[model samples]
Target: MTIKPFQVQNMLRHYGQHLDQGRRMARYRMLLQRASPEDVVNLSQDGRRKQLVEKIAAEIMDSLMVSGSSNPVVLEIKEELEREFGFGMEFRYLPLEPELQILRKEGEELTEVVGEEKQTILQRFWRITLAKVNETML
Candidate 1:
């Protein structure tokens, strides 16, 4: 299934650092103020800070399936998010179900079979993502 656009916005709201860093930090804490007790359970699970932050990051990143296999920007995004937000785990893997993996592999194979002329959809997707990110940063 395609990733829903709302999910993208939610991820950005939860994790993206605003160009105004202090505003972004305030936004995150404001989000926590609305959390349920269960949601806040990670806060004191191991330590007061790092563990909780990593747990929250893992929870957010677990919901995504970034398609690239060897993109440096992916790591850069993760590092920047972690640094800017002062919370987040290192992105080591994206857990996809078997069906999702099969679909991804098929897409890669199809790209090879179709040649470079058939990449408008991917380009459009990237454009949309970048636009969303820029809007969020603002």
Candidate 2:
């Protein structure tokens, strides 16, 4: 089946939202770390902080399986999702738009440092595309 563009956009929005939530949770953890010893002890003792971190981590992981830029994991998930859903998928990783290049240089540099694994990149992109498609259809 063919996936639609709007579906992909929706999935991307969801993925971005979850990722932001995960980042916020991480920031909370950092803030807690910087809190006074008594505050840290109280928060740690409550167990909710630990639970929140775990929950957020799980959400991030789930979102990542569908949206992660990592080559291998994305490929694997794509393959699984496509098999389950029966659709052709594709993804394009164009460089950041020229206007945003300067702001995104560090991320671009990191992706470069990580290097592209061609087979894996293609596989993951396809899988992510499939996921976007599937999510949209639902």
Candidate 3:
């Protein structure tokens, strides 16, 4: 994703240190104000401050993710989100299925018998995955 230089700088101003250190107390105050009314007895305490702040951070990060913005600046913001509030995206690879593995092996053997370039199942899968990653990076 492409992002303007000024936009990146603006994001940097709001994320990282600004998120964890400066705006923390300000957000807490806002939360307190929104949670309780002037006429009602105020029950806001320091005990719930951490939880409230974390909830706010989670909501912000959720909005950012749902927006589908994946610029490098957004990645840097995600890093800060993870570091400061324990909220960010996670990528994981599940194991291949046994049936798929068998099919791949059979395909490799058939290609070898047909005088095509010989490659093990693992090697072919690696090449396919590498090509896909490179294609997406562009």
Candidate 4:
């Protein structure tokens, strides 16, 4: 099944949170800052360095979320997930509807809205899980 843009975004968010829970932001930053132009250029020449670059990129994307920049992180995460899962994913931004705003202001009644969001997120998680399975089969 084709993954929806929103689903990919949700996966990126979940992965970012997972990285934060691991407290690996500092290490990730150090790696990125220390990576030389030559190191980056030579990454294709060395499998280990290539893997390191991928890991660093993932971590940097996660760290960016901590810095209050979620867009770039979301983009990188979507790309990485597509690469790792071998599935096509895209992102599109649409303005939030007025109903959503009203729901947000509903306080306790917002539970229903929150529950719907959570359910959507869970559906995205399942898609990612299936993507992983599909990748393994290939």
Candidate 4 per-residue lDDT, tens place, 1-138, comes to: 899999999998777556454456455577789988877543354565445555544433334423345564345544555465454433211132211111222333432224665355335533543343334331
Provide the lowest-lDDT 10-residue window in model 3.
96-105
TM-score of each candidate structure, all chains considered together: 0.21, 0.29, 0.21, 0.23
Q: Mind giving the per-residue lDDT tens digits that candidate 1 earns over 1-138?
A: 899999998786544333224443455798888987777454553365444444443333332323222434345554454354344332222122211111122323421212342253334333443433444431
Ordered list by TM-score, greatest first: 2, 4, 3, 1
Candidate 3 local distance difference test against the native = 0.40
lDDT of 1 at 86: 46
Quantify all predictions' global Cα lDDT against the true fold. Answer: 0.39, 0.47, 0.40, 0.45
lDDT of 1 at 64: 35
Best candidate, TM-score-wise? 2
Error of 1 at 50 (Å): 29
- Give the per-residue lDDT digits (tens) of candidate 2, residues 1-138: 999999999998776656555655676799778988566443554376445544543443344543445755456655664465455343322232211010112323422212344444444544455454444331
lDDT of 3 at 79: 54
Q: Each model's number of backbone clashes?
A: 0, 2, 0, 0
Report the lDDT tens digits of candidate 3 across residue range 1-138: 989999998786456433343344565688788875655554466435544544544433333332435754435544543454332333211132111111112323421111232134324433333333333432
Q: What is the lDDT of residue 15 in candidate 3?
A: 61
